[model samples]
Target: MAPGARRLATEVVLPVPESGDPVVVELGAGAGVFTGLIQELLGGRGHHLAVEADPRLASSLAARHPRARILNDDASALPQLLAEYGLGAADVVISGLPWAGPDRATQRTTLDCVRRVLAPQGAFTAFGYAHATRLTSARRFRRMLGSSFEEVIPGRTVWGSMPPAFVYHARRPRPRKSAETIDLLAAQLASRAAAATDMRF
Candidate 1:
């Protein structure tokens, strides 16, 4: 496992509450490192979902974290998955996605997904390397997150892990749009694009 991945797993385990039926979701769970830690944190008591894009990792997570429902899909599909499980919202969402910087598209999609599945005042936590935050990519990520989430706060650094790491903690706000709203917006955009193309012809 990579040093950054280890640090992120540790970060996820630190802030979880000891009791309560907290619904947890983990994105980019590569190699089951963070997935296993999340399972341990939950103690097989609550609903846990692990989303991994890699089939092999998803399979490994399914075998290792039997308590967790492994979803072999993209992070963007989170909202739909939560609905399928009848989960109105998640108490926490942990992410360890590898990106060069804050991806606006991903930020928007993920924030939308989080809002749909996160309960009011629920937290969304993700980590990136400390060195990456110093770069321009990190700045963009922060800006994107600021626009999407109600409160974006930086968490403590994981010093024991390699290269060091910092976690971003954001709380979901109330009165947010549903996943259906986002789907409608996407359809509207597609319709507009198709209309423009027809006009050109």
Candidate 2:
């Protein structure tokens, strides 16, 4: 809701790699506060795609960070969007979205999408307000985060933020198996089923 402090932005983008051409994605990139910082950190190396559902905000963010790909679409569609863009998976995902506001289903689905789109070694980051952690949605989000990834680390509270928030740096998401693995397994199962049917015939 609030434009995050620069310090907060710094903490949020900590997972971004300094080396190589990383596929970085950002969700809920409101007003491009974190977007600009990410772009600066990237230094024009990686493909940065920022998803902002709000058309106006997406447009503004696109204008501000022309180098970054700003999409006017829901964050839940991240996997499909990556496929459409011909990218394999995200190396790092930084979210500025408010987890406390979204319902339980929304939270689960979005995080699942992120996990599916993440590379095996990818990292994900999202923030929560300290004062709001006791709320139902916020508490549920924390639990959801824990369940979503193999490792979820809550960073120190950013006193500079308007309401004092901490970032959750998650790694090694538990997205079942890679898409290639799933496809291969499906093909193998179908082959086995066909062989059994032929034998019965």
Candidate 3:
């Protein structure tokens, strides 16, 4: 495994419990290294959804981790994919997605997808190369998560793995107002404004 990959697996496993299994979703599971750790963490007690974009890797994961449901799909489709499995939400979401080369828009979309699938009180954890921490995309990624999540914390570094990495943990946002709710209120205001405008005319 690559240095970053190894470090990611180790970091991802840190927050998981040894018992009282929790439903987990792993996005961008490259080669099942982290998947293996998650399996060990859960001890075959909870449900795991391993989402990988690569067909070859997904197939390999399905074979190796029979306890996990492997999905050969993009991370952006996480919400719909979880519904297909009859999973309303997950207790935790682990991401090994690469953020080095991606633009800010792509990063934002990825984080939004993660937010959509996270359950109340659930967390989304991911690791990025330590060197890439200064990049604008990385900063924006952290900012966007911070805006939506109640808490955004950085965990310990995994020095054993290559290039080193830091884990980012974020808790789900409390419901102040959902998008649908905001839209409805906006429409009502617009309607009232139009009525007033008509009366003025």
Candidate 4:
């Protein structure tokens, strides 16, 4: 769970598109903490589709934010959900899930799903605990994140939250790299990840 600390809903502001009538997607929207914030930022402009895996949570979220078009489905079904909803690629995708908790294959699969539905210049964000970034799965997750996008920038840690967490803002999603490029990417990712090691959440 990213930024679980409730600042009475004032802790962090979910990033929204600057343009009018933008399409925003929310993944793992537990209890609609950021969902409500996103709606307020939208201010009746554009569409907000929230994907919550739990049917019970989705049902309640649907009622709480009727404007969001809540879907009780997995995040991996994002592209299909967008097509069925008749919406094009998303302008922004926000995640409230604890991404590092999953295995490598699962994380890669989910990232692929997100890449498939993001607009060319669209941005994707997910928050995680900085302290855990050094763990094996977390490192793998970070490496995959770096490879999936041309730019993967970690956001400021919300120290106000219990155990603290930070968001990752990635843009310019990239396709799978060739073997030669993969070799070079490994070097780049190492340097990038190393630079963030001293950061505190």
Candidate 5:
């Protein structure tokens, strides 16, 4: 988390729709940085699941926010974890995970899990260093967001932190048939019409 990054995150630009009861999940919530901010914004209206992979940090997070359910698990197990709580998907998933630190495969797997666990209209928000966009992994991660979400929007760059960082917010991809499948169906329909015409002739 950056200096003003937490404030930037809580701002409306991130676009977390406040339904009557919205379910929010925070990944890599080490030391309760974003977790505190998220709790304040949630205003005790809904469930907040704070997931920290480290046992020590998870314990501390649980202590700090007793209302939040702290999960000592990996990001890849999000689907199973949500099932335990009788949730099909989360309304919002905020990630504090270090994208640049993980290997490319690990990053991809974690992102895939996030996408799988997000509701149809849910949003996913994460941050990356302002200067890191030139890096291969950062660029690759941005591309991954583009493919996964219907809309990928970047927020203001917070330059007050040590290195400065910017927020990347993504919405869930629309559920629909793929372009290839639709094209194949069209071709099949055309072939059937042609065969019918030949038979009539």
Candidate 6:
């Protein structure tokens, strides 16, 4: 990661809850670059999960950051992995994953997991190198984000980094009712209507 890019990624607004500590999940935590900064941000008050798909890098991350739990798994399984640790949602998700990839499908899958695990008002920050912005994968990723998030904000370019990069800040829309919840509500309404008809008869 470029120096400027690292700063941009760490500068993301972490919306901590009013009561307890915030939950942070870092994806593609390669070489522990942004790992330390995130730990400092959390200040040991909340949980930080560093996920790296490579076993060797995951082991290194564990050794370097004892305060964080290293998950040696794919980023796409973030929801399930968080559940194993008894964490339902994350307040902020900092991703260093290569959004402009060999193909867009894998990146989409990983992003879907990021959205799934984030709290309704949570923020997701990711960086893309300036040079790669013109790539087809990058363009597609940006468009996908626009459709996925309620608000998608772009940060200033970090020219200090080797190859300048910019940050993409995204927030999900307000939480929507679950399918089961809607079904239950419909059932209750139907029962109430039947009761009213029977009373009239």
lDDT (0 to 1) per candidate? 0.74, 0.86, 0.79, 0.80, 0.78, 0.78
> Which scores better on TM-score, 2 or 5?
2
lDDT of 3 by residue, 1-201 (tens): 776666667767676766776779999988888999898888888789999999999999999999999999998999899899888988889988886567866876777777777888888888877788887567656666666577889887777667778888888754534533543454566568769999998
Candidate 6 — worst ten consecutive residues by lDDT sum? 174-183
How many clashing residue pairs appear in each of the predictions shown?
1, 0, 1, 0, 0, 0
**Regions of model 6 farther than 4 Å from truth:** 1-6, 12-19, 173-201
| Number of the top-ranking candidate, with TM-score as the measure | 2
TM, every model: 0.78, 0.84, 0.80, 0.83, 0.81, 0.80
lDDT of 4 by residue, 1-201 (tens): 344565423333445865699899989988998899888888889999999999999999998898888999998899999999899899888887778899866887888889888898988888888789888778777778777888888877777777777778888888656322653577577767778885743
Alpha-carbon runs more than 4 Å astray in model 2 = 1-4, 177-201
Candidate 5 weakest ten by summed lDDT? 174-183
Question: Between candidates 1 and 6, which one is better according to lDDT?
Answer: 6
RMSD of each: 7.9, 11.0, 8.9, 5.6, 10.4, 12.4
Pairs that collide, model 6: none
- Over 84-159, each residue of candidate 1 has an lDDT whose tens digit, in order, gives 9998888888887864454656666665676667778788887777778766456656655555566888878877
Highest-scoring model, lDDT: 2
Model 3 residue pairs with clashes? 3-162
Better of 5 and 6 by TM-score: 5
Predicted structure 2: clash tally: 0
lDDT winner, 4 or 5: 4
Q: How do the residues 1-201 of candidate 2 rate in per-residue lDDT, one tens digit apiece?
A: 344587888899998998999999999998988898889888999799999999999998888888999999999899999999999999999998999998867887887898889998889999889999888788667766666677889999998799798999999877555423543454566568769999998
lDDT of 6 by residue, 98-195 (tens): 89884766765677788789998888888888899988688767766765677888888878876777888898732333422443454566568769
Local accuracy of candidate 5 as per-residue lDDT tens digits, 1-201: 664755655642245455577788889988888888877777787888988989999999888898889999999999899999998889999988878677767876787788888898999998888898877678667766766677889887877755778889888754433422443464566568769999998
